[model samples]
Target: MSPHPALSEEERARIDYLVPMDHPFDFRPAPEVPRYPETVRRNALSNHPLLRREAARHHQLPPDLVARLAADDDLGVRGLLAQNHPDTPAPHLLRSFLEYTGPERSHLTSRPNFPTEGAGRLRRPRGP
Candidate 1:
């Protein structure tokens, strides 16, 4: 049996409001959300619609949630934290690109995660 009830068309449309076309919503709540006694957390944050979106916003994020996301097992979740974290190491940010292959990595790379002093080099050349 599926863990979550089937999402209605309305819910699916609502999700569309949050993410653009071509973004996949084939995700479900991770078992950890319910605290299954025997299972260790895996991709818990990544599967959550709320968590990933909130991480993307990078605004008014609480430290506890950020820490949880940073330590999340899923590379996507960790990548989001790295992108949003105010102090992600440059080495770590670059490494995430190699380790996690997906739109999430692309999104993070577009942000300001490079080495503090090296970020300028990564930016596009100013228009003439």
Candidate 2:
């Protein structure tokens, strides 16, 4: 037998507040104070997905950090980079478009660098 069979409503609400599935994008303005390069780099490498997502949302991230977040395994991190970061590479945007099925996925297709051409090559032929 388990000690706790299910989460209480309050616990569920708290979890949802911490990580809302419907609203994946964090639009709150980042701090105006300049962050040190090392701090930015550390955030990029943090094990916590929320921290990585924040790093991806920063407007002035170096190209290397943008690339690092674009390649992060977490879908939220990569999606945020593709949606918010101006310097995000086109390949990363394409990968995010293919992988992320969130509500904002349609918005990704409208990004300036998202690859609209060559998608036909990704389709597999039906087996006879």
**Between which residue pairs do clashes occur in model 1?**
none
For model 1 the local lDDT of residue 74 reads 53
State, as a TM-score between 0 and 1, how close model 2 is to the true structure.
0.65
lDDT by residue (tens digit), candidate 2, 20-56: 3455653335568866767667668765566677678
Per-residue lDDT tens digits for candidate 1, residues 25-116, read 12232333333321212223345444354453353345566556655555555565565556555566676656665555555565465655
**Candidate with best TM-score:** 2
lDDT per prediction? 0.48, 0.70
Query: Which segments of model 2 are wrong by more than 4 Å?
Result: 1-23, 26-38, 119-128
Q: What is the number of backbone collisions in each predicted candidate, taken in the order shown?
A: 0, 0
Superposition error at 16 for model 1 (Å): 26
Instruction: Give the TM-score of each candidate.
Output: 0.38, 0.65
Write down the TM-score for model 1: 0.38
